[model samples]
Target chain A: MERKRASLKFLVTVMSNQAASTPAALKHTPLNATHRELSAKMVDFGGWDMPVNYGSQIEEHHVVRTGCGLFDVSHMLPLDIKGANVRAFLKRLVANNVDKLQVSGKALYSCMLNEAGGVIDDLIIYFMDESWFRLVVNAGTAEKDLAWMEKMNADWDMGLTLTPRRDLAMIAIQGPNATQALNHALPGVDSITAHLKPFNAAAMGEMFIARTGYTGEDGYEVMVLAKSAPFFWKALMEAGGKPIGLGARDTLRLEAGMNLYGQDMDETTSPLESGLAWTVDMKTERDFVGRAALEKSEITQQLVGLLLLDKGVLRGHQKVLTKHGEGEITSGTFSPTMQQSIALARIPLGIAPGEEVEVEIRDKKLKAKVVKYPFVRNGKVLI
Target chain B: MSIPADLKYTPSHEWVRVEADGTLTVGITHHAQDLLGDMVFIENPATGRSLAKGEECAVVESVKAASDVYAPVAGEVISANADVESSPEAINKDAYSAWMFKLKPANAADVAGLMDAAAYQKLVESEAH
Candidate 1:
């Protein structure tokens, strides 16, 4: 059931439902029952029966903005890196400078590469130690990610170990009072996660609490044991945390100008063009996978944020018109906080910030301005 | 779920109200808004544009996804609720009050063709099973 160089493997047991194994019928988080109890609108996201919204997505979007909302992100995959020379192996595997990981609980977001410049998956590497690092990857590409990591490990002379922790579940509580909500729900969590800054993680026995999230708000991403997931979720909800779904998640991330993995970029595209040039540390001397490919490649287009001027919503796969050339909108949404439509598009490199372009939305070419991303950060709308 | 008995409905989940001025006020039903989750952006048909019965006239994009708001009957667009365009969430707050647009019927006969509120309610119930 295990193969070399593969980072993901589903211990596929003979399930009665064949469709369940397919992406269309993916598994649900432990909180599915709780979500259904709250009358959440359920949708099939990458095969999982995930909640899109609990009644009103816009209101839930505001909850995360003004208050706190909890999301069941257990569908994401977490891989543990262990064994001798694990740090050395990762330096060759990821695009970012892993050597910069100096602290024990620091987290670094980087793109895993395929050696050909294409992105395998954008992930967060928690620098625990020299012998051990942890990676949390997207749910849809977990299988392929595991396979690639295993294959890369096989070629190395150093002893390495990779383990996917599927028995755990992840939940994120994001908002201004996110930490307080968790502290209220579970006793003693305040001291464990109180002083933790953004992009840092702390381990409290069975729970791995990371102060990181897709939403542009102060939050904690907790990875807990599967058996304890339902209890923790219920406790959070009882402690004033709204059980938010994927619907609010999409809006919150969009308002923050963060990119969705599959929608923004995939294995077929490169980080240089996917609004993630900052994640790729090319200035450092440390060579990584796909570093050579990126050095040789010509970046024809760059990802730029779009602010819709007309009365229309910008959406993905929509055609974009610019003076240099045509491009496509990678991700877009009606920002709840900004109360307007915004998007991120792959346009010609010459489309400078503050430049105006047109986006083809619903057969109408609406005007929009190109701007720097992170539209809303830390509860403030910059653009 | 407030299904106004004064207005008629289409199986596609749009509601139509016949005004004394001979124009029909159109809006998505409460059930429709509930199903769509959260209203975000709406694009009503342009004024003076003619639409056939069951025509795709307007678009209602909820945060969940985008869906077409079918014209309940054939008509010429007379007026659009521009305010809803700016604050689409109003529909979720009060679906009946937040009419998307108003239309002058090309054929008043098509108004008789739509299902009454009670009949429309039955259709909504039947869709579940």
Candidate 2:
């Protein structure tokens, strides 16, 4: 009502987070050698020197959308928590219910939280068993998540070992032909991962195969020994996996309507207002970290999916206006699948999925329609 | 890729070919298409639209991001390439040949102010360093 929109207090974390940005103690995945061979443009992302692009990023995007593109996602940290009461500790540590992950190897996407109910990070937790759980969190949040988990694990008397798997590297091969490429790339991998359902994972020695991805496609997020990453990458490339960059990775995930940990929702925002209300199980009696804050607070706005019908691309931090109120785009991009611009905006409630809103692109306000997120999936347009 | 020796260029990265008809064909240079990545959508000025030098007359969106193509000189759009809008990737495939629009220059002599391919090549090289 006052002014409809502004950047959700993300700057505080990004600003105060001047934690030694130096290259000290930095590590690399095995693909680091292969990326150099391809002459990639490397940049420091969350302390890992990763390739931003090989050469042509747009072509790489198309390669993934139309065929297959492989991404070096080893920067994301995987933490394995073990010992008894692991499930009980996680139920209190995260905003999402751990009870939903009843089946073995089933993964649940959730937001890790601090005591104040603010999001510490968003992660995917694989429920392997009562004694074991694995969490894949953002690269930037690795240190913070480990610290938080360690302190809490000790405080709660949970005999959990928060082991960071530095020995591992991850590769995400996504697009229409994703599954086929991976199946053919790694010898004996298909037989193990051939029947894996969505969000299901299987471990084969040092390699862990998960049928999940940020891209709106049927793909595998394969984690393997850091030493074997280069060989696997080469094999996958020879088997027809075109190497993609972080640029395409952003577009792919944006089009897929997935929330980036820091960009879309952070410590200042709640899962309810961040379009992740469905991920929170209010129906269950279980009380998680952020439950009280979410329960007591009056949610003023909600996150929604948008499709730009105008001539410009919608970008993050851009303002969104509706008759109900104004909001801001958290993540936006020109969708390869839709061939139009799309975004995820936090707008006031009552702006339902079929409504129209205006996005301030440059100086002009362009029309955009609120649609269900996930502009594409499995090479098909859903919006 | 080598920049052609004869064509004129702009900092925004469009290449202009002056024809005997005093008309000009404009397209983004190879360097631009390479930097921008896979072309997905293109919007050119209408045939009759008048534009000032440095005005945004066309828009090009790659899989990575969107960029504006400016009118290199004051001119009236004489023709627009519809084929490019239909198959935007053609620009990435061959940027020089995928001409975006044609313009009848406000003054044919103003082309002298733009960079020749040799100078533009040096500009591109310097920017890279």
- What are the interface RMSDs of all the models? 14.2, 11.4
lDDT of 1 at B118: 86
Once superposed on the true structure, which residue ranges of model 2 sit more than 4 Å away at CA?
A1-28, A39-68, A154-159, A175-180, B21-23, B45-57, B74-82, B102-109
Model 1 interface CAPRI class: acceptable
Residue lDDT tens for model 2, A1-383:
23222111121112112212333445666687788799876655766767778976766777877898999999998999999999999988888889988988899998886655567898999999889999999999899889989999888898788899988999998877887888788778878666899899988887889988998777889999888898889889988899988878998888777999888999998888898888877787887777887888888898889998886677778899999888999988777667788889999988888888898865568999999887877667888
Could you give me the TM-score of model 1 versus the true structure?
A: 0.90
Give all candidates' CA lDDT scores: 0.83, 0.82
Candidate 1 residue lDDT tens string, A354-376 = 88999876656899999998889
- What candidate 1 keeps of the native contacts, as a fraction, is 0.27
